[model samples]
Target: MSQLSETTDGHLLKAITDACDGRIIQMPGPMAVTGVYPERSPPFKTIKLKGIEEFLLASARIGNRQPIILKLTPMDAVDYEAIEIESNKITQFEALEKHLVDHLGGYFNLLLGEAGADGLDAPYIASGHSLNAAITIFRREVEPLLARIKATRLAKAEQAAALAYADNDDWGTW
Candidate 1:
């Protein structure tokens, strides 16, 4: 059981900063921000969170022009536990944490023209391409991954319930 720290937001900030080799920018209130240079150059990437929102907002400029942004939501603790268990079952538990770390790295790559952002709906903030691109990537990539993790979590819960029922000596003693 890892202990949560006040500044790290339950280790989420640490996970992100460590993954990106970025440093946290101190700010007042509940907002947390991390700045990283994927290419170790100008127009770096910034990942921001306001309070304990469900998602983190990330943005960067490609060629120091045209800001690209995306949203990423961390897998819940239960999902992590499920993934850990599944990985252990497959004898790959040792690398499970690394995969989680790689997710941040992958997000950094996405901002560098590694993926396309088009036909993205703009429901908020009519101007500035940030929101649209962010929502697009979130829907196209992040959402499905979240769904898969959720499925794994649900399956784990179901399996545990089934096992408990099986072990109950009076299960059918109605």
Candidate 2:
């Protein structure tokens, strides 16, 4: 398994916000991944986490999904820079981190009836229109897990808690 890092960065926040935005865009069942993506598309370009422009800040539909998948590159290297077109020229930006998070969970509680007291009964995606708003909402949903980590101060505790609460969803086509 890859080593885990305690530091969170803008790129990860961006990815989460993108996934949250997907919650709003595709409302039929599964949520669509959306966020500040490439302002312009280049032919034969590989869609990775790096080489992106943050200035344009456009809502891009990177890929389709049966279930939402949040893929964060890898913040350890601290690489992955985005590019932008400035004054009819190509310029690179280095504001966002390489990787923020890579979480693959269900976001289907939105179409459900009500939420359980555990908070997992509801949808995990945050409702927001802006990037900062998405971040705030995402943080709120994840605060509980963060608090658990801080309180335990042990990887084993955090792992057990996560595993215990792993299956929060109660939906599946039968």
Which one wins on TM-score? 1
Question: Per-residue alpha-carbon lDDT of model 2 for 1-174, expressed as tens digits?
Answer: 122223223223334345433221111222222222343343223333333322223222222321112333222333332221211111111122111112212221321212222455643543312333333444455434444444545666779877776665654233
Report per-prediction Cα RMSD to one decimal: 18.9, 16.3
Q: What is the lDDT of residue 41 in candidate 1?
A: 55
Which ranges in model 2 have alpha carbons more than 4 Å from their true place? 1-4, 7-117, 120-123, 126-128, 150-174
Off by over 4 Å in 1: 1-15, 18-140, 172-174
Across residues 61-150, which tens digit of lDDT does each residue of candidate 1 receive?
211122221223243341211100111121222232343335533443343222223325322212222332432443344433434444
Q: Model 2, residue 122: displacement in angstroms?
A: 5.9
Model 1 residue pairs with clashes: none
Most lDDT-accurate candidate: 1
- What TM-score quantifies how close candidate 1 is to the native fold? 0.27
